[model samples]
Target: MQKEVLIHVRGLQMMDAQGDQEPIEIIVPGQYYFRNGSHYLRYEELLDETAEPTINYIKVSGTGLEVSKKGLVNVHMVFEQGKKNMTYYTTPYGTLQMGISATNLELTESEENLQIKADYALDMNEEHVADCYLAIQVQPRDCKDFVL
Candidate 1:
């Protein structure tokens, strides 16, 4: 991938406990960059109506994904296929234990773009929260001034 790129992130969250699944879809655009062996997508989170915007980074790899947020609500979580991870989710109010288990993970890449799709289940403080799906696509941006 190029040094400067465009990132599209789509997330679906199931809201109901019954068989009827109401998914909430969120789409966000951001800047993408790569360093070493990891790909990073930088974006600002403004959905929570917080005072300050939270800087978020979605780190992608061949085996898993790690998402980190800094600002109003801080959290560092990891997701790997067939593996469970436990981490602490920090917020203005307090901190809570977060658990994430991945059901499926797929990654595809080329010289100019990459795509990641993951399905996972989330648990907060040992209680099942939601089953979620995250899709991220990164494509190289054409910029005259930016050098890759």
Candidate 2:
């Protein structure tokens, strides 16, 4: 992918015991780069009109994926297949302990695009909350074939 890109992120969270919820989707312009055998993506996410946008940084490598967010919210999350990672998630309302246990992680890359799909379980405050799926697709900004 090029340095200037468009990113489409689709996420689904299903209550472990309750059921599935509607999926959330977002498309935004972003910056992408490759360094030291890792891919990096930077983007700003607007939580709402009244709130400041959150800046997100994602790092992807062979072993795992890391996401760090700043601004309106702050968090650093790690995902590695078959491993449970814990971290603190801070938001305007308050902070909570968060955990991610990834069951599957797939990464596909090409000269013009990149795709990532992950399936995991989520825990909040040390209790199992949900099972989640995340898919991220990135293409060069100038690519005419790119679509949400």
Candidate 3:
């Protein structure tokens, strides 16, 4: 069964070369479900101020995780600790060769809530772009005490 959920995402990107940091935070309505052993969170990219909202699917499992989205930014990314995955990022302007190497993946789940933290290195066009950290917190729609 699928349950309605509220998702809060906070991301930080630090450029390895320039040491510039970019931070983004957003809270969106989403759905949470489980299939087999994998947990799935489906949401839309509404706060990006885009003409069309991108549908995002985040699948988490024991081995790794996959994030796929279509619309404003189209990309399918895989993060498995200690392994690098190559992919292409598509935008309205053009496509760029993207690589992601996951350094850490931590997940916690309980009856109360679910939390995930991931750290990785990001590269674009074979050049190091940034070191990234992503944290996601999911809770039932009724839960209001959790803060970003």
The lDDT per prediction is: 0.78, 0.92, 0.89
Q: Which of candidates 2 and 3 reaches a greater TM-score?
A: 2
Backbone clash numbers for all candidates listed: 0, 0, 0
132: Cα error in model 3, Å: 0.5
Candidate 1 ranges beyond 4 A from true positions: 19-29, 48-50, 142-148
The all-Cα superposition gives candidate 2 an RMSD in Å to the true structure of: 1.2
* CA lDDT for candidate 1: 0.78
The residue ranges of model 2 lying beyond 4 angstroms of the native Cα positions read: none
lDDT of 1 by residue, 1-148 (tens): 6666666667776644763454544444577777888788887777477478888888888768999999888888899999999999888789999899999988888887778888999888998878888887777666333221
- Candidate number of the best TM-score: 2
TM-score of 2: 0.96
lDDT, candidate 3, at 10: 94
Residue 49 of model 1: what lDDT?
Answer: 73
* Top lDDT hit: 2
Per-residue lDDT for 22 in model 1?
Answer: 46
In angstroms, the error of model 1 at 59 is 1.5
